[model samples]
Target: MPGTTPDPRSPHRGRAVRGMFASIAPRYDRLNRLLSMGLDQRWRAALVRSLPELVPGQRVLDLCAGTGDVAQALHGALPSGTVLHASDFCEEMLKRTPAKFEPGAAPRLTVGDAMALPYADQGFQAISVAFGLRNIESPQVGLAEMARVLAPGGRLLILEFSRPERKIFSAFYRFYFFRILPLMGRLLSGSEIDAYRYLPESVWAFPSPAEIGREMEQVGLVVREQRRFLMGAVVLHVADRVAR
Candidate 1:
């Protein structure tokens, strides 16, 4: 995440990270659609449908809210007076989204760090991260920070790509992920970015669903449920921060 050479030790170099995302921000949406063949929207929809812990009028935070994908849909689900706070560290990426929100887009976009969210303890009723945890230096610290912002009995929904269970499918997916996806990303993004290449690699390197749930439990968040899809190639993990 530093310069063109990757530093294995710390992947989340703030300024450098911003430039990386900004470099690809323009083609981000188009590439997501083309590469995933529109499965990205399906994944976002699944996140919305699977999110059961957020009540109608509760305040919620969308961590690493890239271009208002989750935030826009989430705003529709909330009742009157419900608040949607979307934040990301990359200003250029955020700017790509409409500066003035669309009708019913109740989001308040802000530039903020995920590992150190700008909110008091128990400030939100629900917190969610979609396709963002892998970018963090310490996902545990980010998760703990999210839990810290949740109110009593609040829940967290994390949607992320995972390692596929089927060997053959995993191999094929790997081919598409490592080879095809990155090729298309480079072609469309018009830059020599290895971000898409890292996507598949990171998914393979990331902890399994059970491991993530255990991490949540360790952080004092009770893991209530988990749903894995595409032979475990993707997972939506849910947990709660109960009142002490």
Candidate 2:
């Protein structure tokens, strides 16, 4: 099972994913910066910018908020009174979030599962997940929970790794992604877990943007827009919660 891809529906998938992330927690931020050549930050900013205009005191949640990068961006972009929350199932990853912000400026960090978020219904005006959805045990269940917590008309911005469409570029992308990236990740993070190897596998296994849009619709969210970057190697899906 050294190179085996994790099945999202496997009963043990969540535990496996959590452990993998936990092992990489310390180097997660650094690895992200290196792996994406800092484009990850720009992608996260795009996700924040895609949010619909939110009123003061409205809430936003950054689900699967690894090290609170997106949550920090949300805090800076939102109005003064907006409440921002960052949640991740892996406590180790959440533990590193506070250092990213000045004393109290950090988004409220919570250790919670995406599939069964702790918040009440319709609580968030917006929710963002950056490159995290593919790690979920069941992305549909995760999206449903996101929809459940989103206030009517609230938006959900998903920035995730997507396949490149151009033939030549895609071949090069795969060579780097599958062959080079994982080796670099393993060497740089010094993690025993196959976290880097898992990355490409998860992204490759993830649903296409069109399929994801349909999944969003099934969960009461309407796809509003999609923007592709890095020659479609990454995508931002902007969706809104439909009133019941």
lDDT of each: 0.78, 0.88
lDDT by residue (1-244, candidate 2, tens digit) is 2223345546458888887788888889989999999999999988888888888889999999988888888888898888889999999899898998999898888999999999999999999999888888889999999999999989999999989999999999999999999899879886777788888888888899999999999999999998999999999999999866
**Candidate 1 displacement at residue 156 in angstroms:** 0.3
Can you write out model 1's per-residue Cα lDDT over 66-169, one digit (the tens) per residue?
87778876766666677888899888777655544665554777889888988898989878899888777788999889988989888898999888889999
Winner by lDDT: 2
lDDT of 1 at 204: 75
TM-scores for every predicted model:
0.91, 0.95
Instruction: Name the best candidate (by TM-score).
Output: 2
In model 2, where is the ten-residue run with the lowest total lDDT? 1-10
